[model samples]
Target: MKRSRNEHNSSQEEQEFLRESKLVARSPQHKEKVKQPEPSMDEIKQMLRDLKKDLHEDMAQIKREIQNDIREMREDIKDTKKELQKNREEMKSMAKEITQMKEEWTREKEELHNKIKEVEDKMERMEKQKIRNNLTITGLPTNTDNEDTLEEALEKMFQTELLLKTKIRRAQKIGQDRCIVEMVEWNDKIKILQGKAKLKGKDIFIDSELTRNEQKIQKNIRDIAREEKKKGAIVKVGYQKLEVNGKKMKWDHRSQKLTEANKLKN
Candidate 1:
């Protein structure tokens, strides 16, 4: 009975040891299998914060791109505005030039109109003077000194029976040295005088016929006057004579008197 009791006790001890070994083996396996506690709210918040930081970084990058695009747009707008201003300035200049041209054209048109009117008036004056009794006499010496000399020369050249009438003084401010010879003609002696006069002299020039029929005689006279002016010669239109105190003084008489006085004083 004592051996059985000791053996039973030993058996109980072996069972206890086997239970402990099994418990030890099961503890490592259970520890490996055991689930850890869920993460704390703080840790989840940290992970979310990291994710938000990445998202914010992405958003910041997008914002930077948008800002650069906006800057480019602003630059484009500035350039467009500058171009527009330049174009406007050019247009203004062109418009000014056009206006100046128009004004110049208007002035020129007025000047042309005035010139045309002057020409028309001159033509009308010429047309009205054509119907007068015109006389033409030739064969007077080109250098005849006075109206009497010219008439005498014409009389000698044209052996016409004509009585001398009063001299008609019709001179011009400018023209050839010419005078109208007044005479009463028997038959057509005046016609003979007109047909036979030849102008001849040294240092004298005269035209056989008046330039243009008597219609443009005034214009011809003006032309002749202009020519005489260039030669420093004065043209006289009426019975003009050198005078002292308005009395007609003969050139020869004055010179002869001056010579006689000088001779006596000497």
Candidate 2:
């Protein structure tokens, strides 16, 4: 039995050896994958340099894009500046045109004002011509109590003092002391004015009825005449003449005179 047991043991060992040998057989397809060695320092540096070059190219591209954006912005700014300059020029032109129009309007307004003043002066002169047949008697005591009695008194005074065959158009008491008499005919106005010397020294006188402006103008003329009288010049304040020392001096306006070496018509 022991010998059988040893033989059995030997057979089992041999079978086990054979199985191990079969399991451990070297197959050509089952080669071990060899891990590559760690890179050397030079190779590592080359890889890092390649990575740096790529990074630099990307950064350069970004920089070029930024520069293009900046250039576009500058062009936009230039366009905006041009538009602003154009607007400024337009505003200046508009302002100049407005100033010119204002000046023209001012001139036209002044011309219109002057024309209106001239027309008013002409109308006043025409009005004075209409009332040329009227005379204002000074120092004539009017009948203030009654209108008919006043007219009768004026009629009687005219019959006595003025020897004129004239009819009274209207005779009214203007103020408390004076009377305005309107004659019927132009001849009557002449006769009454010519016969004023007859009523002289009786605290009365006759004067042609003139406008207030004309009265002021006559007063100015009389003032000039008074000044000439002081210079021993025989000055008379006529309708439009200043007879200064026997020379008919034309009164233009104010104290200015257009003088001529002409004698006064008798």
Candidate 3:
């Protein structure tokens, strides 16, 4: 009976230990679950290949886009260079035009200066020539009968000194009362003689060269008159033929041979 009780106690102790181990394993917090193993090496390699192919496609598309962008940039650069060249040519043309205009303006300015100088010189010459130093007297009474009356009238009209030189006589007759008077200066005589008409009643005669010649002789007579004691000496005056504006007239002498001789003498 004692041996059997000892065997029974040992079996009961073994059962109790097994029951406590089962309770401990059944508690949720203390349980440890087993994990499945990873996939095989071939499966992992197939996945890696798929990912690599997608990455290659994406890289190729990015490279294509980069190439297109580079091509566009190059074209833009080329167009910009062409535009710059065109602008440079335009600037050169404008510069040439400006230079030409400047040269033309310089020429015009010089020409204008020359024209002004010429005008100034012409004005100076005209001013010098404008000095009026002579006088003219005309229209003495024809029937006044004496040289003294004519000289007095002319002296009063011109307000100048007058000298009576000679009394003109007919060729075969005695002295005619017609005479000539002279001023001291040629310019004074020219002023009085040029373009002057003399009126003797109804006849108006243009002052002839005969009148001028007579005036010259009159000047000589006045010089001779100063040395002569006789105041009434007859003075012989020379004759002349005058051609004016293609018209001819005989003056002073009566003989045609004497007139021809006078012309030859002149």
RMSD of each: 22.2, 11.4, 22.6
Sorted on TM-score, best first, the list reads: 2, 3, 1
The residue-by-residue lDDT of candidate 3 on 20-72, one tens digit each, is: 99999889888777898998999899999999999999999999999999999
Cα lDDT tens digits, model 1, 206-266, are 2222324232444444554567667776653211122222333221222322122223332
Give every collision pair in model 2. Answer: none
Candidate 2: where are CA atoms >4 Å away? 1-41, 44-48, 51-55, 58-62, 107-111, 118-122, 144-152, 155-166, 190-205, 212-266
Q: Is candidate 1 or candidate 3 better by lDDT?
A: 3
How accurate locally, in lDDT, is each candidate? 0.53, 0.79, 0.54
How far residue 49's Cα lies from its native spot in candidate 1, in Å, is: 2.4
Worst 10 residues of 3 by lDDT: 166-175
lDDT of 2 by residue, 131-242 (tens): 8788887788764756667667777877788865677788777777787778778788888788888986899878888887777767777888888788888776776556
TM-score of each: 0.35, 0.53, 0.37
Rank candidates, lDDT, best first.
2, 3, 1
**Positional deviation of residue 106's Cα in model 2 after best superposition, in angstroms:** 3.0
